[model samples]
Target chain A: MSNVSATLPRKARVPIFVVLVLVGISIAYPILYLAFTAFRTRADYLGNPFGLPSELTLQNFISVWNNYGIGRALLNTVIVVAVGLTVQLLVAGLAGFALARYPVPGARYISGALVSVMLIPSQVLIIPIYLLLSRIGLVGSLPGLILVYVATGLPFATFFLIVTYRSLDTSVLEAARVDGAGFWRTFLSVASPMAIPGLATLLVLQFIAMWNELLFAYILLPNDQLRLITPALAQIGGRFTNDQPFVAVGLILTALPPLLLLSFAAKYVMSGLGASFGR
Target chain B: MTSPVLAAPVASASAGATGARPPGRARWRTSERLVGIAAVAPAVVLVLGFMVYPVCYAIWISFNKTNGLSFDYVGLDNYTKLLADPLLHKVFLTNLIFLISVPLVILAALVCSVLLYERIRGWRFFRVLFFVPNVLSTAVIGLMFKSLFSYRGPINAVLAQFGIPPVDFFAGAGSAIFVIIIALVWSGFGYQTIILLSGLSAINPEIFEAATVDGAGWWKRLWYITLPNIRGVLALVSILNVLYTFTALFGFIFVMTAGGPGYDTTTLDYLIYTLAFSSTRLGEGAALAVMVFLLIGGLTALQLRVFRVSEEN
Candidate 1:
């Protein structure tokens, strides 16, 4: 092992190995550029695209937040995520509980249909949904976007939670029942404890998806104020074609929320969510 | 209350199998059914009304020839026209490019996960750092990368540092494809790495310990032990990644190149968006949508079958 490590020749010697590393760096360069330019100034950016910023400044970050008003976009994203994930979790949880604990006729059929929904693109149904929402005067509202988010989120969440609830030992529920617990009581006390990891995983995954969604939100919400971070950031491109630093800071900020949530939720997301689909 | 409504029918079905429905049992079942329906009715109604109903309406509209909203049934003409467009063929080819990128993503993800999994220090920080891009919305990432790869963008700047000539990543077709590839790889690999690492972490430590005790080194342990243990997860992640790649968002291409440098990045998703919204060829877009759905469904089914075959071993 020591010999193999030593003979590795301090950074690849073979021609093919050298070529592969070069290719890897080539693939990686743009990403590195994004990181590097975050600190650059407009003059430096235009004059020398790849050189280190002549002078470091936090001015771009401030401009991205204050001038571009991404701070509000970030707040709106939080509101959307909080409401969307809560509604999704509650609705899916109740449905999954019924399917798992109660005798729901055609449960298999309902589950199958929901799973099938996962296969279809949002494009096919989004237009009609738009027209329907327009009829009810929800074309440009935060609540309207939340409604669409919940609808889109339901199928996968239900499928996931049902599998999770079913896989738990039923004896725990029976024990609570023997101790005079009713259905909701047993569920709240017993099943939910064992299912927290699954619930957390779903929340993280769905939150990221909702937070990152652009198409429906862009189409459904016409007002710039109601626009989520995605469409908002997209609009920045219209006015500033050459402002690379602004784009860099916006990209970094936009990436922050999901990265933070995913980092914390990584352990649960893997073990809990991955386990449900194993069969 | 919802449970009783939803469960009644199933309970009754199970009871019917025993062939004795007593009066009290029937009354209780009736109430239970009502409760159960109430519990699940919200989600069911939403799915039916929003998802199923919209799809039905859209499919119906595709058969007709109208503006975004009007009434005219020009049956099959739109479909015929859509089939004849040379651009439709381009869209199919673009979709093939989308399909081709998936393996590259999976291979990169597997490599990154293994490298990061070597009981190394600062594992958590590196994992988070790598995954940072996955959380960024595709539109933002797309927008940022568009600038980054443009003629005066930092990518060209960096090449100059190594005494190399500046390359116009957006000007030429090959370089344009490279830009899209970079964004696709940049945005995707992080998520897969996290998932793959989880799979790696879940392998029973005892298995590795056993391999080590038998004098299995890193390569031998990885080849003979780690790979086999995470096979199911590897299949699942690959399937998920393939589906994600197939549905490459219009947002990225729209922001980055706009399928530009002369239509170099016109994947099926981008083409479908254009056909529906831009070209007003709703029927063709619908056809394209159906094609994407079928392709993803076929791949997912294949994945499941492969998974099952491996499990039997």
Candidate 2:
């Protein structure tokens, strides 16, 4: 170990290590506090919000699940994520392949328009969408919320998939075409397989984003039954007012899914960003 | 899906009929082109409906006063009101103040990325640890900070341990902004770091090895090699980091101070949210939204231009 450390500049090692560790601790501290507080009682939390739990309890989580409606809200969130992810993949994937492979007229403009849509912040669009949805009676519904998610997730998905499809071996696609594979046939046989990695990356990114999306779900899905996890957890915070442990429990439930997702796909997430920006 | 796969072999067999190939293949290609058009139709329609049409409608909304659902043409009343509204001015001012974090976070991320790029001990673990806050919901981080900086919370608790009285963290505009900025930087560091790490990894080792052989120190190598190599990624991240700070500060500000003791922390995004929903002033909100959109659009265009030019150099 001492020999290995000798390769690095001896003078700077200690400060560099300390800085990195400090950063790591700063990042981990709140998360640990969030988790620890969830396992403690209100008295325990109020007495020492920063301290480790002397006695652990599951009552807060139980309350969060039962009264805070986290289970129902989680189900709603899962539905939104599921539907949004599926439609986003299908639409962006299909469109991306078509534009990349076939002579789709106006494909350039369509692609450019989609990418440019990212410049418009979602908040700006929400105002008009709110009005439009109200007129169409999409306000306060799960589908409305899902539509917003799909639209918001579309730009990145389509952009990534287009790049993915474009970078694929064109000669192989050519061989497929010579074998009389039509658009759908060629896409399934060639493009879809290659787009899977990009799609998976987009999936993890979108799942986290849609799961955590509060503004649209708050504005569009005003119905309690359709409320997604973030807003619902936020509501639980207010509903339980200073019942910090329960809210902490709610926060844990809200965070745990993405934590699981990231653990499984962190490498792909980073690589995907590299792919998107490196181009 | 099954039928498309099955049709492939049949179509191939038909195409292999050499004598009739010209007409048969032309017909096949025409149908293929049609299918391609059909494939992209849904996404185009979605963009048209959700983004394009809504933006046009929003422009009209900005020109009118809406009493509930119906609109009365009030000309540029809402637009001028944006200039007159003190809160609106303050919202833009707060956003400007918040913009200070964009470059700071980028620099911090660049440093962290460079450190990780050094293949430091537990680098992978550190990267993931730094990203932990980002993977969680913003509301979670926001609420965490909200609770952490409360008068009786852990931060004050720690301050008291140092023989300092508990500071009123959210009492003044400056301190409230301070806490929110800390939270923003903490929550966002992971993403920018990952982007910069990607940039770092893209740099060729030969150049760095040559620099090492030339007796150049660490800072020299980073300045000459790493910085120049990652210019594209830096530009991209800088633009994005600024855009994020402008729009996505909502969850943090909303939870931390609800725009604060005096609307000091309310960004344009949050202000728009409040005006449209909280005050039910949709017209004024729509006007402000359009202004914000144009502002973002202009700045993004300028950033792209600048980045593109530097990328050429």
Candidate 3:
């Protein structure tokens, strides 16, 4: 170990290692505190914020689930994420592929317009969306929330996909055309397979964005049945103001799905997010 | 999207190269156009319905007074009232407070990315640890950090161990801004670091190896080789980071401090939310929203122009 460390400069190594250790602690501290507080009794937490539990208990998770209906909320969240991502990928993919491959008139205008739409803050658009959704009786529906999610997620998705598509080798696309493949054939067989990493990356991003979306979900879904996890968790916390453990559980429940999704697909997400920045 | 240059060649290639055109080629063209339009129509219509038309409506709202669902065309009244609103000015400063985190967080992410790029052991584990906060919901993060930063909370507890006074963390404009910045930087830097790490990775190794061979140390190599190569990524990340951090509602601000001890951390996004929901001044809120939209749009456009120049190189 000493011999291995000798290749690196000692002066540089010590500070770098120390900085890394500090960072690692800082990042881990909150997560550990979260777990610790959730398990501890209220008195225990008050006494020692960082101490181990005297007696480990499942009461917090249990009470949180039964009282807050996290199970139903979880189901609702899965639907939103699944449906939202599917619609987003479909719309974003078609738009991206068309913008990349076709020579439709006003194509540049459309592409530029879509990219510009990305800059419009959701706060500016949320009221109008709510009004429109109300008019169409979509304000309280799962499908309605999914529709809004797709729209909001579209701009970045299309932009990222378009960039990735353009970077793909054109000769491969040319070969598909020469073999008498149509647009759909070329997209599926030639373009998409090669763009898997990029698409996977987009999928992960869109999922996280849609999953964590609060404003629209809060405004649109009034009924508990339709409420997605984010706003649902907020609602849960509001109901049990005194239940610190319940609030803790709500936080964990809200956080766990995305944490699982990201940890499972960390590499792809990192690549996808980094790709648009040309990483 | 394919550039116009690429598009023209592709269209002609389809039409001219297949011996004489097939009989149904015209039909194919029409079908292709229809398919293309159909593909892009939903997205365009959604944006038009949600953003474009509504933004125009909001501008008109700024000129009128609306009570809930009722509209009364009192031209310039709402705008004038908004101008006189002291809270609006506070909201503006609050947004500025959020913006203060952008440079600080970006610097942290840059340093973290550089460290990880050194090919350190357990780099993946560190990356995940840093990124865990980002994956969590902003509200939940807000809740947890509120506890952590509370008066008798762990942070203050730690401070007490050092014999420092328990500062009123969320008590004032400056300290409230400071806490929010720390939270924003903690939760935010992971994504930026990930972007920077990839950017660092994308830098060609040969450039650095060349620098090393020329007796350039790590700092010299980073300055001359790594930094220049990742200029495009750096520009892109910074633009996105600034936009995102600027628009963030200061969720922790909302849950923890409620934009107070006074209106210290009430950012534009939160102000709009509070105005609409709490104050029920929908017209003024719409105006504020429009102003924020325009400001972000202009800045983003400028950023794109700057980044595009680097990308071209």
Candidate 4:
């Protein structure tokens, strides 16, 4: 590996470096544009859509928050994502723990079922999920949306956690059991602590996924008053095509939580990806 | 340390075997089983309720004419109608066209990952920057691209600077699909790069060194050593990209072109959405949904088979 780069002559190095830089710019430029445009006044954007803003202002953000009901949407998103993430983690954690540590009857079948469902894209289930939710009168409710998120999220979350828990050092768990710790005690005191990195990775991943989820949230909560951040942004983007700055603000707000999470837990997220696919 | 650690299970086993302890052990074993059942029950219940049941219901409703409130037995009618639907044909063709983005993504990811693996200057920053798109919501990326490629947007502005007329990118099917493909590749290649990077990292560095000693140049080494070593990961990434193109492009299409100047860019997922919700053709939508489910399932099975074959080899 060391000599691989050294063997490249100086001339080849420059072009490779330049190509890397160009690719980096292509990735960064549009995001930077969104950020710059979000802070620009409508008039400034209109005058010079591609140029640096003459003056940055909070007016676009404020306008979107107040006029587009993005504030409410943000709150809705927070409630749904927070509650859904907690439930999904708890349920998946328990199930993953059981499958990993205990001789649960039909464990193999249970795992097979989970893995199979993980392959079924949620889009394919949207029709029936919608009908099922409506049948239970959860058609336009946050709790209903939360239920869908947790359910759809469970298969992969449980599968991931199962892999995580299974890879844990068994000696520690054995020691815990030797100390007279029962199942829940061993799980909570020993297994759970050991699996913090996995849980954290799962938390960050599921949070981002649930936060960015649109279809079920949009379809299930068709009422504008209860729109989540993503669907709200889509609505704003679709409606105000010419109001670029306003739409940009909405887009930024919608993306901010996950981006913030990514910045903080990027290592965990990347490791989680590696772990998921490494098997 | 090993003695005590090893003794715990043996101690419990011997105690259970003792004359006075059989009933107690049996009780403990039963309770443990119950606890295990209790622990796994929530996930099982949720999966049964939402996933398993919804799929069965989707299959059932695919054979009926229903609009959420009503169902009339129209056995094979929904399926036949969808099978004959020209719009569905166009949608599938559009999806096939979008599949073109998967190879583009794989190629881009391959080059980027290989370049980054060389530890180029600022590789770390580029890695994070490339991954920024993966973190952002696809809707946001879609809208950003939509704005950038709009008639008066930045892309057109850049063209004007080059003495070319502004292009209305979304005015036609070809350009609209082009814009979506660009967005998909831009946002997609990064995640694949990360995956490919991990795959590349798993390769034995000694092989590269040995290849270098044999006078294998960079391209030759990559084509021979790097490419063959990461073939499994490449296949995984391809399938993932295909899946993303099939299911996850809804957000992009929803925001960017809204399925087009006509049915020109309507992907299968987006078609299901329009049919079930917008057009209130739930029966037909469910039919298409079933078809999509089977398509994905078949793809996944094929991936597993590929892995199994690769493992055997």
Report clashes for each candidate as comma-separated counts.
15, 0, 0, 0
Write the residue-wise lDDT of candidate 2 on B178-295 in tens digits: 9888888988878889888877877767777767778878788878888888988888888887778777887887666777787877899999898898898899888988998888
TM-scores, each model vs. reference: 0.82, 0.90, 0.85, 0.92
Of the candidates numbered 2 and 4, which has the greater lDDT value?
4
* DockQ for all candidate structures vs. native: 0.35, 0.40, 0.38, 0.50
Best by lDDT: 4
**Isolated chain A TM-score, each model:** 0.86, 0.93, 0.90, 0.95
Q: Model 2, A1-279: lDDT tens per residue?
A: 112233358677778888899988888778788788889988888887667778999988887788766888989888888998999989988888877776555556557677777666777888899988888898988888788778767777777788888888877877888787777788887778866787788788778888888888888888787778898877766556467778778888898989988888888766676645421
Better of 1 and 2 by DockQ: 2
- Candidate 1 lDDT over residue span A142-260, tens digit each: 88889888988788888888888877887776566568765577667788889887888887778778888888877888787777788777777646767878887777677667767
Give the per-residue lDDT digits (tens) of candidate 3, residues B1-313: 3243444554455444443232234444667766766666666666666666777877776666665577788877776787798988877766765787888888898889888787666777888878888777777777777667766567877888799987777777787777777888888888889888877777666666666668878777778777788787678777877777657664565566677776767888877777766786777778778878777778878998978876887
Error of 1 at B177 (Å): 1.4
Share of true Cα-Cα contacts across chains kept by each model: 0.48, 0.50, 0.39, 0.62
What's the CA error at residue A61 for candidate 4, in Å? Answer: 1.1
Identify the runs in model 4 with alpha carbons over 4 angstroms from their true place.
A1-13, B1-28, B303-313
Ranking of candidates on lDDT, top first: 4, 2, 3, 1
Q: Which stretches of candidate 3 lie over 4 Å from their true place?
A: A1-11, A165-194, A235-243, A276-279, B1-28, B160-168, B199-207, B210-214, B219-238, B301-313
Lowest summed lDDT across 10 adjacent residues in model 4 chain B is found at: B15-24
Q: Report residue A276 deviation for candidate 1 (angstroms).
A: 7.9
